[model samples]
Target chain A: MPYDKIILGAGLYGLYAAQKCGAAGQRVLVLERDPGPFMRATYINQARVHMGYHYPRSYSTAIKSAHYFQRFCRDYGFCLHTQFDQIYATSAHFSWTNAAEFRHFCRAAGIRCDDVSPSRYFNPGMCDGAFLTTEYTYDAQVLKNWFLTELTKLPGVEILYSHRPDKIEAVGDVWRVTAGEITAEAPFLLNATYAGVNDIHAMLGLPSFQIKYEKCEMILCEVDERLKNVGITVMDGPFFSLMPFGQTGLHSLTSVTFTPHETSYDPVATFPCQQQSEGRCAPGNLFNCNECPAKPASAWPYMSQLARKYLKEEYRFRYKRSMFSMKPILKASEIDDSRPTVVRVMHRNPTLVSVLSGKINTVYDLDEVLQQ
Target chain B: MITNKEKNFVSAVVYLHNDGGRAVEFFRRVTAVLDQHFDQYELVAVDDACTDNTVDSLRSWAAGQAKPLTVLHMSLYQGLEPCMNAGLDAAIGDYVYEFDSTAMPYQPELIFEAYQTALRGNDIISVCPTHTSGSSRLFYRVFNANSHSAYQLRTDAFRLVTRRAINRVHASSENLPYRKAAYAASGLKMADLEFEGRMGDKGTGRLALAADSLALYTDAGYKVSAGVAIVMMVLALIELAYTLVIFCAGHPIEGWTTMMFVLTLGFAGVFAVLTIVVKYLSLLVDLTFKKQKYLVESIEKIQK
Candidate 1:
């Protein structure tokens, strides 16, 4: 039997590719190793629907991804929760200084950016409030679930569980793939795993490189009540913005830099582990999550001091429940394979395309790459 | 019974007044302590809409006293905010301080000090009549560490906001009062004096109960249970670690050679596993709690 397309991974992006292929009434095969789509990495991300901060970082890709995400939610009937435009501090200037003009940029793009006053912390005088394009943060798991739940029923789309793909090779005119145990052939292969694609790229002898993933472990302070009588999402600064997650009464927070790239998968990096769990012992290392015995987090060296200052009083905000960590792509390296130019006889080939979807902050120069 | 030597005083906003238990006794003490200096001042009692004999006792006390003591009652029990607003509206004194019926040996002089401080600075919003027990502070120190990493990014954005700057933090379609710290800055200056041997448990949020109890107990309104979360997380990590072992070992024997059927599932499996792993790690280090910005805590349909 001939398969039209074979996609690796069932993440939102991979599923999307499958659905697209399946729509053509083509045989679509989706292989996922994890039990189901409920836990796809991107689905488990901050669930922060990107607004339009991408213009300042990487105008083109930000626009494309933002447009894609917004439309995807609209098309799929997913309720993305977001307040108005975001808030930035006049007190500080980040790598990009013209942040104030982001409102105009949004306006020119037919989006809204209404300015308002800053609350006590930001506004002792209360003067800074602006409404720009808002990010729609939905339950990423829910959306992923919806897609899996809905798309699995589509015609010609076959979703297999416990199937791990091993390698891909182009035999004759058709592309042959050896995944788990079966060797199958298809015309086209689309690789979109944020990190897993590197292995496939390597298998294809395609220059695929792994960009380090930085994970910031955090506990969400579940908001006990609404922000009191007001319906404003509270965001504090520039690079990191903390808002209230819907219904969960949790703050969609932004405070620490998640250096997942440098983060190790060792059990020693378990302070954050214990902190993630019911704390083992209190104040063992109140200043640092890393030093906390029975519970420690391996973050910045200075993070402990910060933990002492800010995290010390976290219980003040009603801890309804906690969500998971959010991962952003920090670097995307170009893939280059250097094999002596061989005639068509001694064969070798590299993977054709690699697609990535992550927070806009990491796409420093996306158009430049996409164009390349 | 009008002691001419009594210190001048104003009204008190009583909190957690269920049935106004011991209101009469508290008023009797108030009269004895400040009766001399407080002649024209009225005793404004925020009834908190107590279900007990609070209103009757105040009226009975009013009838006998040469001074007029009025009760500002709530139609429905609205919580500390409405009770405070009602008291603030009714208070006719130069000073208004929170008076807890359950107050623990608080010197009458402390209230007087708050009054003095208010008189000294019009910008002083309110005084911390009570000090957080050192134990409470320690809990917060730990709490702060957990939350700081999460909020550090945004706090830095607003760090330069001046006292007069107007930054409005809105949550549920309405504006909150300057994010809690706004009260800390807006004409509300708090001073902590030593209330020796007392654990600062006046009305509701008395943290003087135990040392680590503050961290564990969501008694007042702290909905974010770091303790519970911590427990759930450990279980999740264990599950995740096992899953990781399964994934890395590539042990599941299910044959997946049929390319189209399971291609995506394989990669997605790793993705899911990574999520569990990453999220598990983030638990201990989570600094800021989600503001619980959506749920309207007051809109609960409590039966009257």
Candidate 2:
């Protein structure tokens, strides 16, 4: 019998979609190109359950985050590593919002904020102000494991590893998804393929998104005992965050100005500008910009140079390894550097729904959209 | 409450917004207490958009501190709630304490006691003011009575939380209008200590803040609206029954039946309108805090 839903990604959101559908007593088939789960954007992320602190400019986003922060902890409390405190420090040089403005934003968004000293791990000379806020980092691998375990227990759900959809077609009310030598049919299809969203859209003869893919890297660092169990973020205008490295007990440092670079596949776009693709991808083969294996490049020097300026006792931090991935962002959201999850159901083709999940905490938003 | 041995480092978070003339002495007293209680400690001072030189004073004092000192300066005045949250995030200590530095009787001495209380395996150690203002007490009574969550909040702002309790508060902080209430609702082991309430300038808008916090923790407005609407409907039904009895007895007053029918229909209309408004409010609250499924950024670590 044809499946009720064919989800085209086994990433966090896809897995969640499958679980939601399966729990609702619908048959779900989740297909992933990677041999296992969390091989894409879902795995290679800071894994922060944001509480709207990141979005000082967008009150709606921040408020929504304040809500999601509670639900995420309650539902996936086991997958969270709340051992560390997360700090948001205002940049003395380039932050768009001053310490007071950011605090005001948090208040308006109904997010909790506390004025804390920067001497614990941050250099007071560099930071104008610092705040300790309500935010947690998730162990992505552990979260994926939890999802897999929970999804497995549900009836009428099948997750296929190494199943990449080469072609997707809508025939009447059912969607025909072709993966390698296998072809599956489902009444509804969800395109949760993160970076590969446009690729799948192109395969299904759909309009290409105005999405831009930035070749980014997450620099893992081995810090001494002093920096353990602390997640520190310097608010934007060249932002940087030194967060606890999931369950590894290390630290992950990321810089906004350093990681984002326009790829050749990206339309002619200005730096710090989002670009839209008005044209559709050519039908036939998948045209995913992130198809190539990412090579670890020289990001440490730039990252460390910026980090040392803000961190206290910079000597303790040592570079370990770099993980490269493509970060998909809307052109508009790139300006403020904050975007809510984009969940769009095809109006003409009700069977098809596409989601560009911006954060891990946004799966609930997808659940709501799917229900609609 | 799962209590572990006290870690070496203790963190004290002080909210300093508009603490003008007393700002300097407040920090000095608080730090002195912190110095006495623990060998290793960090003081997190949150400058809550103080127009005065509060941030400057904090910076100058922090410069000389032997222990770690972190000062957060809010760009805009975010009140006490955000300041508490910010302090929680910056604290790295095994035990974290929060108190207003400008409270008339600067009680840095209480920090040690609160820490000791927490050390005894209490998840939350809160300092209850000796004299609770009559109005504030009534507000808490109503708030606790109407609260929708299982754990009811009883104490005030001053608190010392353990690492685990801190985690729970941080997890639930965003949606909670008041941090103290969220702590009480966390289902952790709680202990309350009484402190002499020093008379100072009572902050204005206490009632407004109380009402706002109550609305935040429970569906107070929705519940009242629902209840009132139900009463109106019930009254309208009773009036309709009386009017029907009178009409059946052929003794309906001239134009009385018409007026009663109109009034009954108006009550029904009001009920319908109120139900729609209540639902809309509920939806607004739901969407306002609905967790969006994704964010713009991504983070990954090196494979072990």
Candidate 3:
């Protein structure tokens, strides 16, 4: 079937483009090479939806996308969740010495601040005090499903999952998409697989670009019932930022940084930065989990030390579960990874367009990427 | 008023690995208490492996128990995962609760409460322990145990994921105690019940037993081990001696040198041994101070 738009790769960006183009009354067909529709790359996310207002860019698009998602959930009858309340914090040591500096950073980030009682830190030296933020955490996986469900329901939309687009290009001025025995023709094509940008570039014959990020993370869960009660605490610093997915069962204490290399996004390479400390103890009475020997921090005592300075002598560490990973991205300058991201090659007409983004960035603005 | 319509019944599944000599006694006590109520239930005993009397004890106990007790004796130890899975598979009740036979036998009320609670339709209800911390009212209000927001969020995800398919996925062994994450992932609804005292098997121990310890003890219950107290105690003493040495050494040694020495030693000690303390603390805090019910053979839930 010949359509107006053909999207390459069924990840966040590709799906976002598919949804928007379909919403714009264009028949959109999305081809994915994954064995399944739920591409594990970016769809199964930590669900950290970006407000994007924090950045210098025109956030109107992001706001529109966020609202688009909200509307999608409401209209489709699926629930997508985001944390209404967020608390940003820093170690007590830093808060005491650099109050103005901290306040300034918060102000610029467009977040509100207060000097209330300091919340507790799971890792002893991880962070000290917390200031609340208005940031929301929308569940990415749910949102993705909802978005796809809603988008395909429209008249001009056909979102297909698990199709390897063998050839997609402007063949004789008409774009042809071949997937096994299935064939779809379209005029416009889009690619949004960040990790596989080179692949898409090669397929579309577009210039390949390099993408880099500073640090990625491994998730930590503090097992003590005390910690579970404490809920989510946000500790902020230039180096590490501790945030909790308390509602979702992920309390990630960040000292580790992960960057996806230009060539790879293998979540295992990056390790958490060692937390630096010289003082006896931070302000909060960090509770030691002297219960289970199997918790993550307790399991990696030496590694945890490298992430932070141990103030207490022989203090027990408590951890529940840990999902270990280093972000699979580049920390250095953007260098082109020469792989075709466009699953298919459109003949000569502009049938598909693709963009690659670091995992830290959200595919909220689907319309902006695909519309232009 | 009992209606003619089919009312949802609630029951728990209790799994017993090779629970050493205590297997028979614990099983007897459990059947005795459960039989008193005459509530519909299933008890699955998975004998991982035993060179001892565990199987013999089960054979005799199973011959006479009034309730439905299914015994699965695997030839070898597949670890706790397979044993729990075996027991879970055997559970035909609306709610399948997990318990460790090595801890004290489950308090009878826990069964009644858990069954009643599950009938009300909680996809996954975390059992808040009422015994350990002494401050019941205070602990109940805090977030679900494991303070990590990830745990909190994963719980909801588990419920959503699991409840969508009522019976197919059973419960994930990956997320326990706070099975809420797995519950969300399974698309299950959630409700929490607070245990009044404690699950029976965990009630003993010199300190307090946690779900973690309960799991371990239950996993090890297949053994003839009244174990680990001595090794743990000796390790504790050595650690203590090390602490005192630093404290005493700090007084006479010059200023910075003593502080430096103490700090270095403290880091090394905490780095090496502190995690065990936290794991144990997670166990204790989960049982004593927290406001959720721990698992037993049967946990009650509220139905839709």
Listed in order, the DockQ scores are: 0.05, 0.01, 0.01
What is the overall TM-score of model 2 with all chains considered together? Answer: 0.52
User: What lDDT score is found at residue A93 in candidate 2?
Assistant: 45
Give the C-alpha miss distance for residue B30 in model 2, angstroms: 53
- State the lDDT of candidate 2 residue by residue for B59-119, as single tens digits: 6766666654556666566566655665665455667787744674425667678778877
In model 1, the runs with Cα more than 4 Å from the true position are A82-95, A120-133, A228-239, A244-249, A256-352, A359-372, B1-304
Q: Write the per-residue lDDT of candidate 2 for residues A198-245, one digit (tens) a residue.
A: 777766567766777776788788987777867889985566888887
Q: Candidates' TM-scores?
A: 0.43, 0.52, 0.40
lDDT of each: 0.43, 0.70, 0.44
Order of candidates by lDDT, top first?
2, 3, 1
lDDT of 1 by residue, B79-197 (tens): 55445434433333434554534344556555545555555543222223234455445655654444312221111100111111111211221222123233232333333334443
| Docking verdict class for candidate 2 | incorrect
Q: TM-score of the second chain in each model?
A: 0.48, 0.78, 0.47
Predicted complex 2: DockQ: 0.01
**Better-scoring candidate (DockQ), 1 or 3:** 1
Please name the candidate that would achieve the greatest TM-score relative to the true structure. 2
lDDT of 3 by residue, B1-304 (tens): 4434223322344445546778777666656655555444446666665567876776776666544355555556544444554444333344455653445523545554555555576555555455544432232223334232222331110011111223323312222342332343454455655545553322233133233433332333212122343444555566567667767776544445645655565565554455555655676565455421212222211111
Lowest lDDT 10-residue stretch of candidate 3 chain A: A280-289
Model 3 / residue B7 / CA error / Å: 51
Better of 1 and 3 by lDDT: 3
Candidate 3 runs further than 4 Å off: A41-45, A51-85, A91-99, A117-119, A122-129, A212-217, A220-247, A252-255, A258-348, A358-364, B1-304
- Candidate 2 error regions (>4 Å): A264-296, A347-350, B1-304
